[model samples]
Target: MNWIEIAGHTGALLSSITFIPQVYKVWKTKSVGDLSLYMMLIVFTSTLVWLAYGVALNLWPVILANGFICFLSILLLYFKFAFSRKVIVVAKVKESE
Candidate 1:
């Protein structure tokens, strides 16, 4: 591959991994207290747009990166809601006790 393509792939690789640590941490700790819902929504929306752009242009790097990012974003969103509910339920139980 040419330098330009290499750079694109390199960027794709980096972008794809950006959310991994955060996802892992949230998964491990079952905590979403610090994660902003708006930020996650914005990122998820942006990744979907980028994924569409990549597909329209047949750009493999963009497609791969954004697609993976989309998955990660979804996981984060799910985790945020799921964990938040758990926290709320626990709080209610504690209050009742």
Candidate 2:
């Protein structure tokens, strides 16, 4: 492969791994209370679009990065809901006290 291909693959690898920290945080804390659900929704939606665009254009780097991002965003959305529910429960308990 040429340098360009190498660079593209490298970028894809780096971007894919970048989601690890967020995933770890969500997994460890089971909390995403400070995360913006709306923002993540928009980002997830946009990543889907980007993946489609990459597929249409046959751009491997874009496709790879956005695909992983789509998965990560979904995970984030799940955690956001879970965390929000916990927060609501806590609030109710405190209110009752």
Candidate 3:
């Protein structure tokens, strides 16, 4: 692949892995109260658009990257809501400090 194409894939890989630490932290701590639902929603929506564009253009890298990123977003979103009210309140309280 050309340098430009390689760069694109590199960017895609980096972006796709961006959420790994966040996901791991949240999952381990079970604390997502500080995370904004709206932001996650926006990311999810944007990824969907990116995925669609990639599909339309027949870009595998884009498709794979956005697809994985979208899944992470959705997983985080679910964690935010799936967390119990008590846990959320405690998490928020801790975040305030």
Task: State which candidate has the highest TM-score.
Answer: 1
For candidate 3, write residues 1-97 as lDDT tens digits: 9999999778878999998899899899988878888998998999999999999999998898989999999999888887756666888999999
**Once superposed on the true structure, which residue ranges of model 1 sit more than 4 Å away at CA?**
1-5
* lDDT per residue as tens, model 1, 9-84: 7887998999999999999999999999999999899999998999999998888888999999999999999999
Using TM-score, rank the candidates from best to worst. Answer: 1, 3, 2
What is the lDDT of every predicted structure here? 0.94, 0.86, 0.89
Give per-residue lDDT, candidate 3, residue 47: 96
Q: Number of clashing residue pairs in every model? A: 0, 0, 0
Q: Largest lDDT belongs to which candidate?
A: 1
TM-score of each: 0.88, 0.77, 0.79
Better of 1 and 3 by lDDT: 1
Per-residue lDDT tens digits for candidate 2, residues 1-97, read 9999999788778878776798799889887877788988997999999999999999987887899889998888888888779889998999989
Error of 2 at 67 (Å): 2.0
